[model samples]
Target chain A: MDERFALVGLCPAAEQAAPKGRRPGKRPALAAAFLALMVLGCLLFPLLLTKDPASMDLSNYAREPDGTFWFGTDTMGRDIFAMIWSGGRVSLSIGFLATALSTVIAVAVGAVSGLAPRWLDALIMRLTDILLSIPSLLVIILLQAALGRANIASLSLVIGATGWMSVARVVRTEVRQLRTSEYVAAARCMGGGTFHILRRHLAPNFLASIMFMVVMNVRGAIVAESTLSFMGAGLPLDTVSWGSMLSLAENALTAGAWWIVLIPGLFLVATLLAVTELGEWLRRSANRGQSNL
Target chain B: MCETLLDVRGLCHSFPLGAGRYLRAVDGVSFRIRKGEIFGLVGESGSGKSTVARCVMNILRPQAGSILYRGVDVCDPAQFRANRRMLQTERQIIFQDSSSSLDQRMKVADIIAEPLAVNHIVPPRGSLRAEAAFQLRYVGMDPAYLDRYPPELSGGQRQRVAIARALTMEPSLLVADEPIAALDVSIQAQIINLFRHLQAEHGFTFLFIAHDLAVVRYLCDRVGVLYRGKLVEMAPTKELFDRPLHPYTKALLSAIPIPDPRRERARTRFHFDEAAFDRTGGFVQVSPEHFVLGGKEAEP
Candidate 1:
């Protein structure tokens, strides 16, 4: 974006338009707005696009981008533009599903460890440490291979299962701090149930920590899927994910069809940037009155 | 009204300072609150006043003690579990720092009504919101503050909301641990008056803890004076104030500042002699409704 701004900066009209000192809320809102639009476009991919992304048109195969075909066509004659959007739907779904799964696990572990007695807290933390010692990507691949399925759903489950350890550590630390808070003591004194305290007292207080974690997990899941599919372990080519879309990059490289690789890679990188910017923004706000995770 | 509502016997608590050592916060401190009576525990800072209050409210499990609330031993795990809801519901605590004591994210209405909703008790006033509003009004606060959060309110307002929260359960026992210690001088009197008015009208039993002698004398029915976590004196408030028996109690009373500069400068202030202090001293009754800890041997 800054590069584009610099290019536009050569023109005086554009230089006059770009204002500085936007309030803290504005930048994140712009990023969130872009993400929301991208998500909407991906979700409504079928409704917006007329071409069948999977169907081959041998005569128009491997053509350069033109007025009719925005991202041109891949070697198999599949529309690269349609593939990017449709694959985005899969990528974002994995991000959302994996994020939800990991968040639930993270909160549960964090709450338990944070509120538990010293020895028990040590035990839980040590277990997390052991899990953290092992590389998560390797574990996800091994789990996926052992399950004998590389489908999108199972892949998300595997990624999610492996992703919660770090966030859980953050949550446990946050919860430990929050447990000493007077309101929690007051809530306990009122005879609120454990679940009630967790939901009512603990959740809202540690929400910022969890929000940043959730956003980062979405970004992580997307990258993990892309990496795994770029390798041979992710969803099959038929599933049409961004990772699977990228998996065909080697073939496109051999065929010298640059659009097929560059278009999807550019979209994925841009999406990752927006997601990362939003996560960092949330992290900065969370840090205003809290310890950084 | 004369019946004991809460009885604490041999309360002793210590926090481990690591290195196999303990810092005893409360040691063998015991007092009773009769039904519909105000019982004040007065002590200097680090004198275990808050510890005693926390032990009574069952927020901290004492190392050695039996707290009998309504004649049930709350320290025994099985017995406490059996009557846990009753004990917890009937006993509420108002912590000193109400801004932190009250959930900051929760609105005033939710803060007050949380105990009702959590315990699944049907509100007597038709709805929890109504109960909350009534509690707010009872605490001399308008229902208009219901939508506001704790951070938006002043320290005194937050303390009032804390009181209102405790009152929603219509708790028979209210443990106020230095509730006004964090308030300004003017706000302290307002809160003290509010507490006095609330108790007179509702007859709620109170276990008030404070370092402020004047407020305790004005508000409490009976007073217990603690010196270094030991109960040095116990008597009715008027009796204790007028005729303090122990040397430490005398020293404590003397510490209260006199208003007039003439009397204040000329007043004889008693100082406690640590050489004369004895931890082995047992309670000895010198007069009706009055007891002093020293001048007697340890009793079996």
Candidate 2:
């Protein structure tokens, strides 16, 4: 009987062939290029522009765009072009730093909660649920108000603290699913410790999800930082940011100096768009990589 | 009599189904695997054969039972923790789904080397590579395939890689849960042969779980028939095949289609009636080395 069953067929003919040549699509490429250029411009813009963004020129207050002031003077007579570049640095840094802090915390908390004992997992998950239920903007505002001042560092910290809940949820779900996989069971049978199974098996499998979360969180942090600044709870008055610039342009809009609001708004919208496009591209590519596996 | 390598006594495990309901996965299962022997646990899907394997492997702790390996009671938490390293080194498992059983992100060489590395049995770099290559060759794959990932390999090749990984630990016992169930028919024979060869060479005991009787009969020395999480019958493979004592065993045997067309057409299968029997009773020994459940008899 065994021989008959054995001789019934050779190897299955429809074996999964290796994936063929893969190339990055055009949209992601353009998005990536744009992001790179923006980052480079942010880094080099302040040095290349001769005027300091914060230096008020009361003599030239509310000047229109000319060769001397590419983006015109704001209500305070600061160079809008230099202020825009300087603001870009602050916004980008806050975004990057906040994303980094949140991702680290999320990965650690998520992995532990997912792989922890039943009681601990329940406790952690309940805590996360509570955090998720609260309005994040309100929490950030309360934190900023309590702290009494919103600097670049404090604003980044506030955004990071509020933003990790979603990432934690994503990682927790992924880890929980991975824990039940046969490989994890096999690892356990082979006498693998909890740390070993988590580090070697679960972590690598869920890395793509983690990466996707980090990128998405960066965009979230940028928006959160801008919102805080727009609401007059962001950086100090002397420090210029896209959000602060928009806030300052409110009075100028009544006087019809539209460039003050439009220029900074354009920067914010373009950066956000680029980031969203890049994140979408990353998610698609990660999915493709997973399907290939 | 051969020395007993493993003895499981009255193993019981259950899963909660919410609202205070429970699904009994393994109920009062008892078995022993002698050294240098292959013990087969055969049952239909969802009959809890895999659960038994997991219980024996210590992957899942049985709510009520004692599992003794080499005369050490592994069911005791203290003993299990104290001897964990030794037990882990001695017992390993090969899973049914080879693709999922392997880490997708890892290369083949890393997958095989993981057990050794995690156990801190780090050989020098050259020797480690050599050892991985050796196991690959032993499993009938070329060394060049080590750099590739699990997704790149065929199912048979992936199973072979899994087997190679298991062998890397040099385990005294291997709990194979439907190891060949996912393979092609032709590949199944080859893997079965590989198991046989490896057993002969290493003298390792195997707890082979499968739903296919023909394959179990080909590989195992002793066969235990599990029906709905209970051991209904157990005997030497040949005896069980020749004279199946339990009604479920008879039904299983009849279900194996004969190769001859006339006999295959003429065969009458016995349908099991679950409502007819008292499943709570213990096994009754009908003959030496043969046991049948749900009959009045003297206890061993």
Candidate 3:
């Protein structure tokens, strides 16, 4: 039998047909449920925050925590809670949007590269390697510098452009494997064209790997955007990003106005952790589904 | 066996090895499968048996070959495409390891209906469920199994589903590549018997590829022996088994153990000297419809 055509061997009937007794443990769905709620809460928080993210009270600059402000005030006397919520909207959205864009780019490039003839596959993978070898953050920085200051769209394009190489490489390997699978040949036997094979046979099987990459990249994108903001390359100073808030609080840190940096930093950490955890959970769930088959 | 439906002539395929080396995987193999005949292709691993099957199905192009279906050259891409619908409807492949052959995400019904969907034989919005149900029952699968995913099926059941899926196209040729090798021994016999029964009922031609001679003997009416990349010997099943002319064929046959260990010990032990196996010679017809190549008999 062709190794490429070897069955995934996890079919549902495989379990029933096996002369065995014990079944494997399935993934607990609660973790995903909790993570989903957290993501929804984060997504909706900015929309719920009534005050303008940049709206500042000059009289209350650097004020300590009080009943009026749940998270006290930043250097500009902006409500830390409101700013964090609003900044989170940009950070999280950019992360996900950029990750999605990159995933599409990578999957397309990789699948094409992998399924193409040997020379073409090598060409695409070599291009991927060259892109992957360069420091992604440096590429983003260079692009941002050359292309001008960071708006959400520009930042996303830069991050997305640099991020696709890894995904392309991963998807390329998967495509290479899938291109030779029996179902793929079956589709061909049914007179399916290359596009049909790509759309039906190759794409769906590798979607899980792509999704996992997207989730991980979201964390990376968020952190990248925050880093850009800290360097004064991201959203405008008045935009009240968590990064800009951190930038503003840097001077106040020595004066013991700790809430200026601490709260926003915690928020960034939580968001990254939440997304990473969510990605890991999704990967495990997919694996469990395979084993159950 | 019935009237010949597919005629393959002088098929040769060679792939470029690194550093300008040429590795031949299929060398001048030729055979004719009659309509409703079970033609077995037997070889060890790397013997090019699967490659031959691929060439017959046009999954892999042969550098020098002509596959004639009803006297039409199927090797030509344009002609093959022109007859694509007929090809799909008249020929199908049942792959080894049914789970891998089936799309994991698809339900049993959807998997069976894929050919129909792709060919547009069934309307996009038509009663695909009923069609899927009909195909399922054709392979002895229960209609209730339709809603279930591939993963829920056992190996024997999955192979049966694979057979059903292939037969759904109403193909005259079913290229089953090591269909039962991935299955357990106990289940292998059942799958083999099911194939036999289906062939008996449907009168479908089968290009059954396998490394197992015993199984091939049970399933095929005519047998072709593949060695490395060459078709070393081909004859009617009984003749090929009784009088294997090629050294490779003789070696392969000797390796098949007789059912009783005591009788097996008494059988001649053929030496498969790899050094001698690598030597090459062109095929020569020794008897009517029987050929042998790369041995002292052919050389002299």
Q: Please give, for residues B1-300, the per-residue lDDT of candidate 3 as tens digits.
A: 358898999899988898999889988888888888899999988888877878888888999989998777889989977887787678899888788888887788888888887877863336877888776666666678888878877888888888878877778889998998899997787677777777887888889999999999988999998887778788888988888877778889998988898898899977777676643576678778777775465542
Q: Over 4 Å off in model 1, which ranges?
A: A1-24, A248-258, A280-293, B296-300
lDDT for each residue of candidate 3 in A5-27, tens digit (9 for 90 to 100): 12222122222555453434334
Per-residue alpha-carbon lDDT of candidate 1 for residues B11-90, written as tens digits (9 for 90 to 100): 99998999999988888887787999999999889899998888787778999989899899888889889998998899
DockQ of each: 0.24, 0.39, 0.30
Clashing pairs in 2: none
Candidate 3 lDDT (Cα, 0 to 1): 0.80
Q: Provide the lDDT at A168 for model 2.
A: 91
- Model 1: lDDT equals 0.86
**All candidates' lDDT scores?**
0.86, 0.86, 0.80
Quote model 1's TM-score: 0.90
lDDT per residue for candidate 2 within B11-75, as digits (tens), equals 99998999999999999999989999999999999899988888888878899988999988888
Show where candidate 3 strays beyond 4 Å.
Answer: A1-50, A291-293, B123-126, B147-152, B242-255, B268-300
